[model samples]
Target: MSSTKRLLASIHDVSPRFEAQVDQLAGVLENHLGKGRFAMLVVPDHWGAAPLREAKAFQSRLRNWSDSGIEMFVHGWFHRDTGQHSGAANFKARHMTAGEGEFLGLEEATALRLMREGKALIEDIIGREVAGFIAPAWLYGKGSLAALGQAGFALAEDHWKVWKPGNDEVLAKGPVITWASRSAMRTASSLAFASLARTVLPHALDTVRIAVHPGDVSKPSLLSSIDATLGRFARSHRPARYAELS
Candidate 1:
């Protein structure tokens, strides 16, 4: 590992609905960093439907992961999109995530409520405090930001930067290298982006994030890219937890 660069390997959407996929991807990531070298963004109740409390087996797995050094962060409350969007946000919701912006247009109160509940539930279940909160699709509304601050969440992330809530302190700045396989165009573009980033990013940035979603396991190309990207970065950077960045 290079002393000048750091990497964050994150597994997204850890839920009962995506259990098998999550395990598979985790295994893949482990091959790169060993166990406990990554983080898991947990959805308390994915799509406001699949609640973690109901999945006893999955809860146990999460607890073990937590104990073994996998950092946990509360993701969106429901991991769904229920509000309308406009401007750049609208375009992002429509294109970037297919409308999975859970915190994009939430009211301050609503956002706070969900954030508090989700964080509390995750902490209770895992018997450890969650390190941060990241909204679904990396979209955070002004209200959501306000809510995060009021809720006393110390860390939060948007697409290009990681920041501390209440203080507006930036911890890192860089576009995350991630993949999307929801459609043909998205898959093609994502692979192109991954390839380009792998070739270009190490020269320009000190910190890089590789966020892996469960759906990525379904695509062979994505898995290959993930492996190559991780391998490439590992040669020149050290694995880091998000908390260490701050």
Candidate 2:
């Protein structure tokens, strides 16, 4: 497993900035996990107040890259505040969607209602159905399990990517291509290059997945770190996307 050679990246926050960064990350996935071997996490329905606009833009850019067939998973109904805050590792439980409407306090009926509406809206815009889901920050309340399964997701990458809500499990996992903060997008070009550097090192022999933030591309040092990481990883592993495994 340590010598594995695939890359699965999850993304959030769909915006014009998102559209730009996703392109660079897709390129990393392409170079490392070529030919139907990469995956992108999609917001599907998000915006903080903008709704599905960013999701649509992101989808459009991805569709353009479909010739390579990079796969996508519906990330979350709302990638914002469902009782969640940034600036911490514990975001695992707090992050959710505005559509999820006060997740900690809402009744299951309300939560399900918001999730369903978000799904329907995204599907309408994409002209197809979503196959998988990962909650924002991989955080979900107990009630979320049944509702998500009922919503029809075949695969999930939550809380360590272990197959779940179940009695059985699989090695379904991915990586976090993150940096010091959320303001990293200011240096996209440099960041992309830094990822290339990392892909070539001998140390990253495992099936690696790098998590990217819209902010990663903003800092020169951070961007350089990413490219360096990618370069280091690529020295030994063949680039692969998750859809190929499915």
lDDT of 1 by residue, 122-190 (tens): 999999889899999999888998898888776898889999997999999999899998998899999
Cα TM-score per model = 0.97, 0.67
Residue by residue across 147-211, what tens digits does model 2's lDDT show? Answer: 65566555666545535333335555444445544333434544564455364433542445556
Best candidate, lDDT: 1
Badly placed stretches (over 4 Å) of model 1 are none
Which 10 successive residues of model 1 have the least lDDT summed? 91-100
Model 2 residue 197 CA deviation in Å? 14
Model 1 TM-score is 0.97
